[model samples]
Target: MRQEFTIWLTGLPSSGKSTLARLVEAKIRDRGFPVMVLDGDEVRTWLTLGLGFSRADREENIRRIAHLAMFQNRSGVATITAAISPYQRARDEARRAIGRFVEVHVSCPIEVCEQRDVKGLYKKARRGEIQGFTGVSDPYEAPLAPEVVVRTDRESKEECVARIMERVEELGYLPRGQVRCEVIVPADLVDELGTNGSSLLAVLASREARLGRAGGPVTAEEWEKIEQRLRALGYLR
Candidate 1:
C-alpha cells in the first residue's frame, strides 16, 4: 500500500459512476498500485443498512462512506468511491474528509442515463414506485469544481477508463513500483467459509464494510451454514 489518497466518482444513477470507478481500479491495479473501490449499491446493504432515501439519510450515507474511505486512506491504501452522492454539500464533505480526494464527475445527460437504465430504475422511478430518485424525483447537484470530468455519454469505456487512469496519474495516485493485491473469490464460498476457508472473504467483507459499513445480506440458512462450519472447526462460540 502507498500513502493514502481518495478518488470519488459522483453522478446520477446509471450515469457510469460505478463503471468508471471499476475501470479506474483496473487501470490502477494494472500499474501495481494498491487500490480499493467503494461503490454505493454494494455497501447499502450493510454500512448504511437502515438508511432510507430521505434527505437526512442520504446525507448520513455519504458521510459514513466518506468517513470509512478516509480511514482506509489513513491506513495507506488508495480508495476509489462511486455513489450518486446528489448533494454538493455531501460531496464537499467527502473531499474535506479525505485531504487528497479527487472528485470526478461522471457526467451524462439524464436522457442518456435513462436509456441506459439496464436495471430499469428509471422506468420504476417514472412509475413512482421509487422515490428520491436522482435525475428524476431528486436533484443531482453537480460538483462545482470536480478535479476531473468524465463524460460517459461521449466516451467509450476504454477511453473513459484510460482517462480515469490518466487523471489518477495526474493526481499522483500512480507511480513506479506501487504494489496492491487484487483478490478474487467465489460468492457462495464467501458466504459459507465460516471465517476460515480464506482470508479474501474477510478482505472482501471489509471492503464492503468500508464502502458504507454495509454488512453482507446473509440469510438465516446461510447463517446456519456458517455457524455449523464454524462449530465443526471449533472456531466459534
Candidate 2:
C-alpha cells in the first residue's frame, strides 16, 4: 500500500504471527512500498528491554509499540507489528492511538501453537519455568472484532496473505493494484497456454458451467487479444 498505516499482528506465541507479518511486509514492499516489521522478540531486546511478563508490563510494551507506529505513520512509513499482545485492552488502546490501524488476528489453536513451538516455551511454561506465560499461566484475550482473522492452523502462507490483503484492500488501507488476482496465468507462460478450448480458463469455465461463471476483469493478454481482433479488421495501424 502507498499510504502509511499500521498493520498490527496479534496472536498467541508460535501462532505464525511473525511469519505472516514478514510475508505481508514482503508483499507490500514488492508493490514499491516500504514496510517496517516490528517483531515482538526483537522489540523486547531493543525497545522494551528488561520488561517482564506481567499484565502491566505487557500493556506498557504495546504502548511503546503504538507510540513508535504513530511516529512511523507520521513519517510516511507503514508498520507491521508481530506481537503476542495477549490482551484485548492493550490492542484496543494501540488502535485508538494509531488512527490508521489494521488489527490482524493470527489465529491458531493452542495445541497447534504448542506443537509448532521451536523455543520449547510451551514446555517451559507447563513446567513452571516461565512465570505468567500467556495461554498457560496468563490469560490471552483474543480480539473480539478484528479487521482480519487468519487461521494459520489450516490456511497456507499464500492463503493467509491473500485473505489479509483482501480485507485491507476492502478497508481502503491497501492500494487497488495490490489486490489484483495474480494467479491468472503467469505472464511469461500466457502465450504458450494460448486461446485453445482446453486452456486453463476454458477448463475453469467448464468446471463451473453448472454454476455459470460471470465475466471478470480483463487480463493484460485478454486486452491484447481485443486489440489484435480490432487490428485484424483494419480498425487501427
Q: How accurate locally, in lDDT, is each candidate? A: 0.73, 0.74
lDDT of 1: 0.73
With a 3 Å backbone cut-off (N, CA, C), the pairs that clash in candidate 1 are: 32-178, 46-214, 46-215, 47-212, 47-213, 47-214
Tell me which residue pairs clash in candidate 2. none
lDDT of 1 by residue, 1-237 (tens): 244688899998999888778878877777675678888997575456567898888988898778777765655567899999999998887788778888888999999999998889999999999998988899999999988888889889888777766776676666545555543334544564555553432333444344442333544454455445434545444
**Model 1 misplaced regions, further than 4 Å:** 176-237
Q: How far is candidate 2 from the true structure (C-alpha RMSD, Å)?
A: 19.6
* Model 2 Cα lDDT, one tens digit per residue, 122-157: 999999999898999999999999988999999999
- Measured on C-alpha atoms, candidate 2 has an lDDT of 0.74
Model 2 ranges off by over 4 Å: 178-237
- What's the C-alpha lDDT at position 234 in model 2? 48
Error of 2 at 74 (Å): 0.8
